[model samples]
Target chain A: MIVAERKPLDEIEAMLASAERVLVVGCGTCVAVCMAGGEKEVELLASELRMRAQASGQRRRIDQVTLTRQCDREYLDALAAYVEEYDVLLSTACGAGVQLLAERFDGKLILPALNTRFIGTAEGPGVWSQRCLACGQCLLHLTGGVCPVTRCPKNLLNGPCGGTNHGKCEVNPENDCAWTLIYRRLEKLGRLDLLDAIQPPKDYRPMTKPARLVHPAFQTESAPPTK
Target chain B: MKDSIACLGTETEGTGSGAFEPKVVAFCCTYCAYTAADLAGAMRLEYPPNVRVVQVLCSGKVEAEWLLRAFEEGADAVYVAGCALGDCHFLEGNRQALRTVAYAKRLLAEVGLEPERLEFFHIPASAGTLFAQRAREMTDRARRLGPSPLRSKQAVESRKLVLPPDPHPPLPPAQLGRRIRESEEL
Candidate 1:
């Protein structure tokens, strides 16, 4: 899922200084699960802005609303009515949701309230750690479900580097070496022999490209008659 | 004679007769505290009428700024009531609520307001009597403490600031660059 973190309050306050009517839009999907942009966050931010305005003796009118999924057009339609009521829209969604809101609103001033982080999962309650770089490839099968591309500082795909000491990464002693985790998993699965196989340099073409997806079901209807 | 009149005026002001009734804002979780308050009303339980309850989807929805704003806007007391631990409708909402409230207490103390003015309670929705009891207790405590010094009549009237919906929007690339530079220098 898309992971994100809330921008500082002072930073957000400066963004809406020019607008009188502002709308805070939150997404209830991936961003919500990560606790970045969600219904609760929207209300908290709205109240904060109101308080700041009162303290600063500034006249501002802020409103908040949340949608099921900001990236989906169907869910974004729920914001149509509320959208017209504000001069600016603050989206607490992931990067995709922020872009989607900008595209849907077109001429309106749209802003992101979160810093899009990475594709990750909750390590524990209130903690989300990066797990994937989404390099348009999966090498986890050979690495025991751990992605060195994200966990390793150098994104190494092979065995442990010299920087690894006592199963911990030298760069961050607190973090366990990804290679160590991979080795233990491989050893448990009786696939330690696979580690000896030398991996060639990965293709950079897939990582450098823009996002793309293909589905066979969707292709059939769009494909024209073949000669 | 003028001196005697001035002394009498000072005495009258010090007595604080006809002082404004303290305004208390309570953020109640809908699943528990709010329902409990509703039950209190239905049961015809008499508690202080000073509190104005704002029903939020969850106690976690209550922000620290809201509590500060309540005080800034002339609320002598602010209370947040949520479900007991492990009983939140949206699991961990109460826990987060507790943390936020604790933070607000420290912040309030730092700002010269009595930290005791802010309170947090965890009660089940079925505990209507407890809700009433807590409400009355808070009101009495606030009454004894009197109005917050920061909540003078002028301060109350001055709190009519109109906030823009998104008071702080994300800065454009240019402004962000300037901000980063400023921070680095600092």
Candidate 2:
């Protein structure tokens, strides 16, 4: 799931300095599960902002709302009726959700309250570790289930780099060497032969930025001629 | 009004001399601390009237939002009183409350309020005197700290009727009460 962390309070306060009426929008999906952008977080933030404004005599009007999912157009449509009431919309969603809000509300100032961290999974309660880089490639079958692209800082697809110290990565001793994990898994499964085949340089064209996909059923040949 | 904010005593009961009387909110778990409070009352143990007691099912149920809301609603100081350490009715409710209090304290500091204004107390049902002492301790701390910064804003807000007219105007009293309570809990 997409992970995110809230921006510092000082940074958020600075963003709201000029906006008298601010609406805090929370995304109740991935970010919510990560405890970054959720209903409770929105309330906490709104309360903090209110107290700070009261302390400084700012006279600001801060409101909060949480959408089911901010990345989808249907959810973004909910804000259309009242978006005009606020000078700024502070979104506590991942980058995609924030950008979608910006696109939907083109005239309004939409700012991100969270920094999109990574595509990761929760390792434990309140702990998240990056698991995928979305490099438009999958070599997990060849290298056990681990993605060397993300787990290995060097992204060495062929095998472990010379820096694999025992079972730990040379760059960070705390991190387990991805290749070592792969080798052990393969040996256990008697699939170590998968490592004998050398992999060529990866093709990077698929990872080109701003990628999009139209469903096979939704593909249109041409636009109908306007009458 | 929804979930009754149990008030042990009235807020305006002054201590004379135009002194600032801090309004302290104490969330007591029913298993231990609340029972202890009852014991304190039976013993006629005299403690300051400034502290208001809110009884909850367990200290673990005392959420971070509740602690924050107390201050937001003009509480000078707030504390969660639960079963002492391992003696929690739910086995680990008091420990959970300890972590919650610590987290709330950091949040208070972030909002420019003194973290010391919020605390957690471990008081078993047998410790009636200790419960009263905790109340006294919080009240004294609140007195030394003075009124919370949020109180002045609350005073100003109270002077004016800020609530908009109810949108759905025709609910029964119980349902309306529940609705308001639900919103408050949110």
Candidate 3:
């Protein structure tokens, strides 16, 4: 899931400095799961903005709406009916959703209310950790199931760096050496032989910015009739 | 105050039962303060009826939002009672409650309300006397602060701060349409 955190109240207040009418839009997906941009957060932010605006003696009207998801146009249409009523649309979604909303709205002033953090998995009830870098390749077959690309601060491909102290990395003592975790798991699985093979440079083509993908099964136009 | 600001969608319900008596909402841990309150009643201890206890499985269930909502709904003061340190049934429920109150107090003060109106107590379940004493203490403190300024004519205006449903300086729907279309070219 994607992780995000709400921006400071002062910054959000600054964004609405000159605005008279503001509509805060919240996404009920990733940011919601992360406790950042959910329906509850949208209401909280809207209330705080109204309180602050009134304090300044400058009149501002605020409203809020939460969409099922903000990364697609279909969900955004729910907001389109009244989109023209407000001068500002403050979005509480991840960066992808924010960009998509801007693209769909075209003319409305769309601003982000959250700082999109990273793609990560929850380690515990309130704990999350970066698990995959989406490097467009998989090396878990050779180095155990642990990922070194995101775990290692240096993104080391081969083994632990010289800065590794015992099993901890020098980058931050709190972090463990990613290679050590991989090595131990592979050792326990009795797949140490896989480590003997050398790994070449990673392919970066699949990870290009603004990347797009279409599944082979979805290419109905060029395919022969199915069995 | 307008009827919209006069009421909050909170659990305190109704405009309270008449008179000018201060209303105190107490969030009590079921394992500790709730049991203590029961014991206080059984022991025939005396405490003001102004204090109302809302029970929870753990004091940790009392969120900061709930505390603020209590204030919005005519609570002259809010108090959270839980187990003493090192004795929470869920290990750290009381500690979590304490942290939340500390953080909430700052915000309460910042928003022109008395921070002293919010408090937390760590009373053991068997300490019925302490429960009654704390109840009287909270009631007295609230009486000293008088009613929430939100009730007075020289309004502090926290109620008016409720968001949504109320937008400032209403604009004509027709004007909003043309303005949005004109701005679209930018």
Candidate 4:
């Protein structure tokens, strides 16, 4: 899932310094699961803003709303009814969700409240570790299940580079060497021979910026005329 | 004092002549702190009435939003009173509440509010005296801090203009007890 963390309160407050009526929009999806932006987080933020405004003797109106998923047009449409009620919409969704919301609202101000971190998985309670870089390649069959693109600082394809210090990355001693983990997993699976095959340089073409993909069935104007 | 600043949705107690009386919201775990409050009452202990005890199944059930709500709703101070460490009825519920309180304090600080206004207290069910002491401690701290800056002039004016509905209407205990007994007998 896409991981995100809320921007600092001061930064968010500064974003709304000129705006009197602010609507905080939350996404009940990936960011929600990560505890960055959810219904509860939205409420907490709204409450904080309201209190802060009142405390500072500033008369500001703050409200909160959570959409099922901000990236989808259907969910974004729900805001159209009351979109005019606020001067600004502060979105607490991932970058895609925030951008889509802005696009859907067109002409309205939509500011992000969270820093989209990475495509990652939960490591433990309140801890998440990046697992995928979405490099548009799958080399997991070659190297255990870990992706060197994300876990490795240098993104080395076949690496136990000079920076591998006793199974730990020299860049950060706390991080386990990605290649070391791959080797041990392969060794345990009795597939050490797989490591002998030299892997080529990664192709970055598919990962070009602003990548868009349409399903093969939807690529053409007409769908596959009813099965 | 009441003339100068009206109540802002918070139940203010002992509105002593012109002196500030802090309103505190205490989330009390039923297994420990809530029962301790009852014991304090039975013992006729003298404790400040500033605290409004909200009984929860466990302190762990108190979410960060709830703590934030207390402040937003005009609580001058707020606290979560749970079982002593390792003495929680649900094993680690108190520990969870501790972490939650710490997180809430950070949020309070982030919002530019004094984190000292929020606290976590560990009081076993047997510690009635301790519960009262904690209550007094919070009350004194709130008194020292004075009223929350969040209690804006608007809240004061709104309170004067509109009277909110009674959240908990007085329940006649005699009739309530008879009704419960009748249902049980039936």
**Whose lDDT is higher: candidate 3's or candidate 4's?**
4
lDDT of predicted model 1 = 0.77
CAPRI category for model 1? incorrect
lDDT of 2 at A39: 85
Query: Which rank order by TM-score, best down to worst?
Result: 4, 2, 3, 1
The parts of candidate 1 lying over 4 Å away from their true place are: A220-227, B1-74, B79-97, B103-186
**How does the DockQ of candidate 1 come out?**
0.06
lDDT of 1 by residue, A1-227 (tens): 88898887767877877787788888888888987788867766675565555555566677777776788776666566667767899889988889999999897999889999998888887888889887877888888888888899888877889999999999999888999999998999998887888888887778775666778776656677789
Per-residue lDDT tens digits for candidate 4, residues A61-165, read 787788778887777765787779778999999999999988998888999999999999999899998999999988898888878888999999876889899
Residue B142 miss distance in model 3 (angstroms): 7.7
Q: For candidate 3, what is the lDDT?
A: 0.78
- The best candidate by DockQ is 2
DockQ of each: 0.06, 0.20, 0.07, 0.19
Judged by lDDT relative to the true structure, which candidate is superior, 1 or 4? 4
In terms of TM-score, which candidate is strongest?
4
lDDT of 4 by residue, B1-186 (tens): 121112336344446576777888888999999999999999999899788888899999988878876787678999999999889999999999999999999999999889999999999898989999999999999989988887533531111011133233334557889999999999
* Cα DockQ of the candidate 4 complex: 0.19
Q: Give the residue spans of candidate 4 off by over 4 A.
A: A221-227, B1-16, B155-186
